[model samples]
Target: MAQLLRQLERICGDDHVVTHPHALRTYESDGLLQYHVTPRIAVLPGTADEVREVVVACHGAGVPWVARGAGSGLSGGALPVEEGVLIVLTRLHRLLEVDLANQRVVVEPGVTNVAVSHAVAPTHFFPPDPSSQIVCSIGGNVAENSGGAHCFKYGFTTNYVTGLEVVLPDGGVVELGGKAVDLPGYDLVGAFVGSEGTLGVATKIVLRVIPRPEAVRTLVAFFDHTSEAGQTVSDIVGAGLVPGALEMMGRLSIEAAEGAVHAGYPPDAGAALIVELDGSGAECDARFDEVVSLCEQGGATGVRIAADDAERELIWKARKAAFAAIGRISPPARGARADRRALA
Candidate 1:
């Protein structure tokens, strides 16, 4: 173990290698705090080559290791393995390339999910958008195949990921896929994605982006019961209207979000749906009307359309904050995993 630590330190400077118990405690678990295991050591690699070196050293030492991104995973995917090396990849963050012509962006593993969209916001956007987008790393999303509210329309991480520069378990490095749409042979890139880090560590990623929609409309509909809202969702789809997003919140979730962000949802409503539609202005306007009619038919007690971008932002703010807002209603101890799952 001592020799392994020395080798890791040699690969990524001593300052980057962590061994202090106090510092190691922070990495014991990820967002899923229920499972915790303090790793024997943690190393922050600054570059892909450095990561390879560290991995090579660990492989030679016969030491197990795990790669961690922003540690925002809710499933303990980033939980440290006891006595193993935790390879912290945050230091590798860098937007390596942006090809507007190909609508592709190349980024390091540690880049936050939102940063990708922000980088190309003027012309294009990467659209997976998990709830934790603001803080979750792209690498973690790739590991979990994370999908957010908009994933109902834009698809998940696997849909956007085009290529990967991966460091294998045995310290060998390989490239899979690329800027092109199709690659010959096996779908290795697809397999590596959502493998939960069991395949290897992705050092760099190439992702597909799409041009911004011509128009966008957001509306909130309140129902007397959860079943009513579910029916409304079904009706909208049944009408062949593919909105960009359709998200539902039970009363508890509504109260939590309203308290956190004042999204202005009806207080007594049993359930609420945040519906978003986008595309050509004419098509969105026509479809949005049909959506409102369907919601009313499905027994919505009241319906409100976002009057402006600020209102739309606030509505989404509430949705994204729903999980953390649960604490406002429930006691800290009562905020169990089951309660969290309910919000999901």
Candidate 2:
């Protein structure tokens, strides 16, 4: 172990290779706190070369290793193996390039998900917006194939990922896919994505972006029962109205969000459906009306439309805060259980 540490320190400065007990504790577990095991050592590599070097060192030493980004994964995908090394990628955070003409952006593994959308906002945007986008790293999203409320329309990480620079398990580096839509060979990119870090570590990613829609309309409909809201969702789809996003929250979730963000949800409503429609102004306007009518037909007691971008943001904020709100409202004894269920 000492010899391995020396080799790692030689590859990346000693300051980047963590070994002290206190520092190691921080990488012991990811967002899924229930399953945790302290790694033998944790190393922060700043470049793809450095990452490859560390992997080589671990490979030669016959030590297992795992790559971690932001430690925000809820599925224990980043959980460390007890006798293995944890390779932290936070130092590789840099938006390498933005090709607006091509509607694609290239970023390193450690860049946060929200940063990508913000970089191309108002004109174009990256579409896979996981609830943890503010802090979750893009590489982690690729590994988890994460989806957000808008996934019902835009699709998940696999859809937007056009290319990847990866460090294979045996310390080899490889590039799969590219800026083009289709590659002639095997679907290696698809297989690598959603592998939960078992395949390799993504060092650089090329993501496809899309032009912003001309119009966006957000609406929230209150229902007397959750089943009614579910029916409304099915009815909207059955009617062929493809909303940009459709989310449902039960009374307990509504109360938690209301307490945390004051999203103005009705306290007595049994369920609330936050739906959004986007496209050309004419299309959104027409489809939005149809959605509202369908909600009413499905037994919605009340419906509210977001008046502007600010209101739309607030509505989405409340929806995103639903899990945190559960923590705020649950008793201490049941908080862990509630969080587990929410993540599940």
Candidate 3:
């Protein structure tokens, strides 16, 4: 262990290699707090070259190693291995390139999900917006194939990721795909995106970004029953109205979110649906009105359309905060989500 630690220190500076028990405890677990394992050491590699070198050193020493990003993942993929090397990638944070002409951006694995949208805001936006986007790293998203509130319309992380610079388990570096669409080859990129760090470590990622919508309409529908909210979603999809985002929160979920952020949720609601539509101004307006009618027909107790962007953001805040807020009411745990149809 001492020898491998020295090798890691040489690869990434002494300041970057952590060995103190207390410091290593920080990497013991990710958002999956139910499981924990204190790694023997954790290395912060500053660049792709450093990451490759650290991995190579561990490979040479035959020591097990795990890759980690922001440590915000709840899937337990980032749980440290006891007596093994912990390769922390947060130091690799960087926005490498922005090709507006190609509608793509290249970023290091450590870059936060929301940071990408902020980097390309106003004119463009990244679609997948997990609740933890502010802190979760792109590498973790690639590992977990995470979906966000907007995934119903825009798709998951796999849909936007066009290319990856990955360091294989044996410490060999490779490029899986390019910016081009549908290259004639095995779908290696697809297999790697959700491998949960078993296949390799993503050093760099190429992501597709879309033009910002001309207009967006948001609504929060309070329901007397969860079944009605589910039926509303089903009806919206059945009507060929693909909303940009459709989110549902049950009674307990709503109470937790409202208590946590006071986002103005209806106090007596049994369930709530936050539906958003985006695209051309006229299209969004028309579809949004139709969606309101669907909610009413589905037996919505009350319906509130966001008057402006400010109100829309507040609605999203409540939905996004709902996950963490649940911890206040119960033991902190990342609950499993069933298929959207399960509500119905």
What TM-score does each of the candidates earn? 0.94, 0.94, 0.94
Query: Positional deviation of 102 in candidate 1, in angstroms?
Result: 1.3
TM-score of 1: 0.94
lDDT of 3: 0.91
C-alpha lDDT of residue 212 in model 1 = 93
Angstrom error of the Cα, residue 152, model 1: value is 1.4
lDDT of each: 0.91, 0.91, 0.91
Model 3 alpha-carbon drift over 4 Å, by segment = 179-182, 332-344
Q: Write one digit per residue (lDDT tens) for candidate 2, span 116-185.
A: 9999987998889888899989999999999999899999999999899999989899999993556477
Ten residues in sequence with the least summed lDDT for candidate 1: 330-339
Which residue runs does candidate 2 get wrong by more than 4 Å? 179-181, 331-344
What overall lDDT, based on C-alpha atoms, would model 2 receive against the true structure? 0.91
Better of 1 and 2 by TM-score: 1
Alpha-carbon shift of residue 177 in model 1 (angstroms) = 0.5
